[model samples]
Target: MEGRNLASINYNILDKSQQKLTIAGRLDMENISSLWPEIFKLIKKNKPKVLLLDASGVDYCDGAGIGLFLKLKEKQKENKGSLQIENLKPEFNQLMELFEPGQLSKPEQIPSFFKRVPEQIGKSLTISMREVYSQISFVGEVFVKFLYTLFHLGSLRWKDTFLIAEKSGANAVGITALLGFLIGVILAFQSAISMRKFGAEIYVADLVAIVLFRELGPLLTAFVLAARTGSAFAAEIGTMKINEEVDALTTMGLEPVRFLVIPRMLAAVVITPLLTMFNNLFGILGCILVMITMGFAPITLINEIQHATNLTDLFGGLAKTFVFGYLIAGIGCLCGLQTGKGASAVGDSATRAVVSSIIAIVVADGIFAVIYYFLGI
Candidate 1:
């Protein structure tokens, strides 16, 4: 019964083939060795049909104690006799649960590749469908708020809208112009090489103008915005979401979508088309520079561009820019608003916003291209 003493084991022979082993005191590392000899001796000599281990008297047990029980259980199994544990403490029960053996000897059977492929595909489809539903619902809510703000002009946050426009549009002008100019220069250079073979280098001007105004201008502008402004939007809003500012706004009866999203959306819608137009102008400027270097007159280049491009081409590109802007802004806001909890969630949202916006822009551009082709524009 002394605290320093090892666990004491007492045996009670119940019958010819039945026996009980009572363990008392602590069964930890320092004390478990004392109980083993008696247990083994009884097992070897009597080889009882049933061994009942009464652990009620045990005050504490450790890993060693659990190992001892496992050894006893294994010996009982070898003798084809059952080992019945009695009066186990709740704490010991928990310990046993933690150390319990699983069926590791019997490995799990993996399904065949063909069987797994359809299952994976179905899971992917289900996830994709859920994401689509979430995005559509978010878009619908934003659209309703946008319309309401339009009708009630006072409700529109003009100051925030202007600030966002300035940041997303004005700050981006330099990069947009540079990219546009480079694209035009590259296109003209490539085209002029082929045109020169046929003594039709003048046609490079037409090619550059048509391509820049009808396709490259809008598409390039969208990609730039998606990478720059779209990611920023998501990060900014996602930070607010994590800080509980969005929830605080909600508690204060201010709709976060209306207050935060509407301004950014409007800014994108108004600024993207203007930026596209500017991109087109800069691209043409670059083409002119190239053509002048190639011994073509500036006036001649201007005339070619004027002749090759029309109102339809210009407006079609602008319309596509508008759609791309809306999608980029909307997707960014959606990703931000849907951000999960954690430090990495903001970065994840930003990345998702950029990727999703670019994808939406590309898909929307393709749809526009098909529609324009059908309409003969």
Candidate 2:
């Protein structure tokens, strides 16, 4: 036989009831096709009561070889005899085990729904705790890096910071102004209806100024940034992560958090308050327009606004914007850095960033309200 097709079979008739079949060579598909037919013919002609297959010399095998052995075993059984496999190499023994019918046939038990409920709850709680611990640790690391970079001004990317500021603040002015104007119009229209009955229509200025400056301005600005800039940060960082750009930064001894996150955080901190101020301006302008249509002079509306709102109200709103900005940018960066592998991961991170930032802003705003009430701000 050619060396390329090197399968060979030898039969030794030990006795009337016994025979041995020795197969030596590669038992892959090509060789098995020619070799199996001859081997089966010998077995059928001899009609041995007991057959022993020696497979120690098999250097390679495939599924066809295993199928051949199973066929021989069945043939021997049909002849009222037995087939025994002997001298199998470790690799071939593993192959034989794979074809064993009982390997994966174990019966499985189904759990009751009541038992599964607590089990699922426990698993979910464990996963949530682990995620909380990881997030806390990551936040701590980012804070330490931020403090270090504060002393090393050259380490900060000033250009990136300014670019983010412009994108998050300047580019968002149109939408912010439109939203603020509409909110102001709605508030004035609704309040004017009630106030005109009591002959207190002029106090509409006080209501609009107090509500906008103390709450709506900062809250609405935060909502806008959380939806726009926050989602952008998460998507940008998540793409970097998937492309291994973050890993490359680590390999080059650069801190990804400091390089990527700090600039965005600082920009948000500077821009959000400024945006809130602009939103307040547009909101008051909307109220002015409404009051002018109601037969009040522009000067009269301005005077009422000035008399009604104090510096404390404006400053309180600005202060809340700062906190909201930090939370939005920080949460966005956190979600991005924590992105898992996959194409869907970027979308998921962006969604999580927006949701988490909004929740944080709302909770923080409530806490601020409580604090201001206690401090009499």
- Report the C-alpha lDDT of model 1 over 252-352, residue by residue, as the tens digit: 99999999999999999999999998899999999899999999899988888888889999998999988999999999999999888998999999999
lDDT of 2 by residue, 58-171 (tens): 777788888788878878988989998888787877887788553335677768999989999999999999999988987898778777777887989999999999998899
Report the number of the highest-TM-score candidate.
2
Quote the positional error of residue 337 for candidate 1 in Å.
0.8
Per-model clash counts, in order, read: 0, 0
Query: What is candidate 1's TM-score against the reference?
Result: 0.70
| RMSD in Å for all candidates | 8.4, 10.5
The total number of steric clashes, by the backbone 3 Å criterion, in model 1 comes to 0
lDDT of 2: 0.91
Scored against the true structure, residue 18 in model 2 reaches a CA lDDT of 85
| Candidate 1 all-Cα RMSD | 8.4
Task: Return the lDDT, model 1, position 374.
Answer: 98
Estimated TM-score for each candidate: 0.70, 0.71
